[model samples]
Target chain A: MIAADGGLGIVATQRAVLTENGPLVLASGAQLPHVEVAYETYGALSPSRDNAVFVCHALTGDAHAAGWHEGARRPGWWDNLIGPGRAVDTDRYFVIAANLLGGCSGTTGPLSIDPATGRPYGADFPALDMADFVSAHRGLLDHLGVDRLHAAVGGSLGGMQVLEWALQEPDRIDRAVLVAASSRLTTENIAFSAVARAAILEDPDFRDGRYFEHGVTPRHGLKVARMMAHITYVSELSLAEKFGHRRDTAGHDKRLAADFEVEHYLQHQGESFLDRFDALSYLHLTRPMDYFDPFGAHQGVVPSTRFELISFDTDWRFPTAHSVRIRDQLAARGAAVEHAELTSPWGHDSFLLEPDGYHDRVRAFLS
Target chain B: MIAADGGLGIVATQRAVLTENGPLVLASGAQLPHVEVAYETYGALSPSRDNAVFVCHALTGDAHAAGWHEGARRPGWWDNLIGPGRAVDTDRYFVIAANLLGGCSGTTGPLSIDPATGRPYGADFPALDMADFVSAHRGLLDHLGVDRLHAAVGGSLGGMQVLEWALQEPDRIDRAVLVAASSRLTTENIAFSAVARAAILEDPDFRDGRYFEHGVTPRHGLKVARMMAHITYVSELSLAEKFGHRRDTAGHDKRLAADFEVEHYLQHQGESFLDRFDALSYLHLTRPMDYFDPFGAHQGVVPSTRFELISFDTDWRFPTAHSVRIRDQLAARGAAVEHAELTSPWGHDSFLLEPDGYHDRVRAFLS
Candidate 1:
């Protein structure tokens, strides 16, 4: 929450009980007894609450989507795209970004205490699906007395959640903007995630997700997992352009230090992630994306929700083909959808960055 | 060294002194007092010893390129590409396959005993370069009384060695075929290898590469490393075709069991690697490839050796672009060079299989 001495410019995080009811029933027939969502907002809500734009954060993201936090070194994660005079101008639209369900960033997730056992759910955390993620997102909106959404903008896994929320609440969402998202995961995609899961699950310190009580975490396995994932997040061209040929690697440096520039960059990414992310949260978030098959039955339709899907040219993670497929599926189901494959060297991470035309396109769609 | 049980029908593995000279000096200035190579020869060497063709192995490969090991369940790794009348026809040319230096498969590597201490070298094994691999390969040829090679063929890492050998000894090699090979590793390529190295090095059982005394190996790290590599070795399309979709995964299966079909396949690939590979050997072998820059100085030339570089359409590991670059380089250096981007359902592993028009192209090139 914004401190009592809250300043005018710096935005602090706020928490709210997502649901007014007792327990939230998940799509998997599981029940979350208590669900609290952490959120950050910018600008003012319209008198009718019709200008509320819900922004869904991607995997590993928190409610701090924009604006500088008090005493912080830098602004929020997407501070580049969502601020005053920015493409996602806070002056025009009231933006609401929340920590999604099954997240460790203040949302009631695996790290949250179980009311019955009075212990962190840990391995006992129930399985979650896209609908469950959407449910939590909508619950936060309900608590704020918002009846409809002006738009829902998300990227990567966040994009998946937006798609789910838009599809389920067709009439409530006017514009559903999905950036570098997938309607389903491919065998290769699952294979990559499987390796990450193996690294964490097989770690000796993991102790079967109950590592919290042991005062140690699966840092090694999680680090490897993050390093591998970071490689996929950025394109080959971007990595080369960012850090060109570094020839400092030793042939038999049994220690395997961060010899190459790219290795050093990846090592930092992996190391820093351990401080903010929980192994269980990672497992919870990524697994749902692997099994996400919204168009499996071709029943996913959103007639009232005009869809705007943007994909990066270099994004092999969820390539333009994935956007094309999503477009085709939505169009076939009689939903209005527009898609674009933008140029960027940052691969799957292009959506997060202000890649040339990316911000402009999103702004144009929002307006 | 082929045992008495070896019959005329089955080509059994044989061991020979790679170098008769005292301590073969390596490119890195490190010397090995005794070096032995495990090799297998198919067909007969013609008089004048001019019909000899060298076959180099890729990462995790060995001397068993073709034919069956006495009681083995399967033929060699590249059995389909070599044999009596396969593309690498053993009948027309005497095909010799040898495990490369720093290899764990019956070659003097990290697991080999040090002459001075009489203990496994482990981490003490000297560093290696492409030139060193070529030295060992040439030594094997000298032992067989073969002065010049009719051709040298390899895929992936093996293909890199062939390039180095052809450049160093242009006149000695008549033909050099490099399939799915890279002349130099890109930043992204090295990043992947770096993650693999991290997984193996940070393994608890690694013990600074002296795990031999502990009677334990870095199996967990090695398994994770292999799993990640296995994903890159195959294409997204191929993986999708092989394993469509099996969605039995539980989000919080905290155990991270092989619930998905692809997960099961990857798990099998990772687990099976531990049985045939060594951790230090994996680290040593992969690191050199990251630093291989034969064309960096641009003095590399192979005037007499006709070069044939083949790349698969789906092989993203070392895509057709890698072959095109190599082709342009060799052609500019006054060398006879040709390259083809072949169609294959498989990725980098396509070299070991008989894809449509693949075997025919090789046979015609060899003839």
Candidate 2:
């Protein structure tokens, strides 16, 4: 158990192994002999196990969703949303957060050892779809004896999972909150992800995802990938307001050193991301995000599950059009779906930035 | 002279050396002892030399604005708008297109030898500004015996030059056409350029812009930079229509290979750009673009040069707001200015793509 400031004081990320069914078959027809899921519980499971709220995370997020680790100065990525009396309100409901299937945060991913070769899976890790991620989450829920979830909520890539959960097993989730996400990746999304993957792969140290064995990381390539992705995460307005044409006070040296505030900010973001994330994991995870398409086969059908779709006006990544499309799809089938295109200059990251509007919507919908 | 199928049947790039001047003073407070300008001319100069139409090229453009070069498969970059009877009409006006001061083509730039060291300027090249570019063009005009220009026209960075031309020597230019560009770089422009520069600098091969001495090129870094910039050149709608989530027929290799069509397109753009552009020149040119702010010093005053502003609706790089701002500024100062917010899915490159509307407007104004 770990102590946090505002949220559940005690939180622990526990692991579950699913090995009873020989090997788990992935969407790509590959198999994992055994799967290990790392999950954190914010509160005690309800007596009936019906008041459980599952929180999924976006890319770079992990099971540490609401608390402070032993030596950590900052709380989890979504600590602002999940706390004692916050949006999710751990006091009334048991909250569960898990590291994704193709993730680096304590989850069995590319960095994990392969039983057959006694080496990190690396490039050998099977391609996984959103269904595989949901399946692994199901393994954890089944192990915890949770028959049904009160709600499944997430934003961005995490939100993709929330939609997948409702589509894959509607009865399992009573409600779903998908924020700043889309049912499928847009062309722009695929384009951006493609460039990012190229950056990592082109790095000399990458060695076809064998950088770990080479005793070096593809830090330069990964930094470039992060820098490219960071541009899409924030709105132009926000970027203009935050950085603008403002040069670093140090003055321009006419060299490679960052002269603009935005450049310095991007450099910092890229460098910091390398410390916590694995390059291979980023590649593995982003592929499924581009491949996710639950409505591909049933474009005209409306999902029966109740949904709350939220999008920020400034979010060009997953614009309001995506949320509106989902809302219209559900509404077409007479299903209950609420969508709000909230105005925020924070862009796609508005979900994590504006607490009042976003929290209120989540709280009201969840209640 | 080079033969061509359309427009002017024959054209050739000419060079002018400005050695008579002791040194060319730059906005950065540095000096270049000598400067050479590469320029191309179409049609004949009028007896009075007042029928000259000065054409400025964009970031990736060159002095070859119209007509074909010897053994070249394609015509000039602005061939569509500068042909015999086209918008600028080579038959009606003497068109002058000069490579920018810090450009890589045949112009004096980072690749030029520094007389003092007998080595390429590389990182040692003095920082330049828009005014420096205009100064070089002015020198070319003086050498050509052109006293005044009927019009100064350009799009994107070229448009920056057009604005600078009117601002620096208001009496020399009778009119200016600024298309899909602004008087200064926006915050987003600076941010994008910063990332591009960072990508080039971060590459190990860049060698602090001294890669030329090592007989190596920072192609990887330059490619990444081009890929990032290419995304901004087109609209999201255009990208979506041109290259959706359609994957390459060769199947995903689960590696860094281009899977999506957009990835393939960006890779091609990046690779092809490496053959024609220099990394140091890109760095040098993009800096002045960010630092360009002609209105900064003379905000309240608008020169008497006639102005034509064109912006595409989808050009988020230099949105209609930018053109409108310019229009408003010029109009408030009682300058003759015409602004058009045209609708086009091509984004910032619409000025170069939509020949009909853009050319018609230019033809009407210039005629």
DockQ values of all predictions: 0.54, 0.53
Off by over 4 Å in 2: A1-5, A249-256, A298-302, B1-5, B249-256, B299-301
Worst 10-residue lDDT window for candidate 2 chain B reads B248-257
Docking class of 1: medium
> Top model by DockQ, which number?
1
Q: Largest lDDT belongs to which candidate? A: 1
For model 2, give the RMSD to the true fold: 2.2
Residue-wise C-alpha lDDT for candidate 1, range A171-212, written one tens digit per residue: 999999999999988899899999999999898888988999
Q: On residues B54-104, what C-alpha lDDT tens digit does candidate 1 reach at each position?
A: 999999999998878878877788877777777887777898999989899
**Per-residue accuracy of model 2 over B1-367 as CA lDDT, tens digit each:** 2234557655678899976767887766788987899999998898877899999999989999888777777888998888788889877899999999989989999999998899899988888777888889988898899999999999998898888878777878998999998876667677778778878888888888889889998887888888888888888889999988777543323333676788889889988999999998898888888777777745666677999999999987889988988787778878899998888988988978863477788899998
Instruction: Give the TM-score of each candidate.
Output: 0.95, 0.96
Q: lDDT by residue for model 2 over A89-168, one digit each (tens)?
A: 88778899999998998878998989889899988788777877888888888878898999999999989898888877
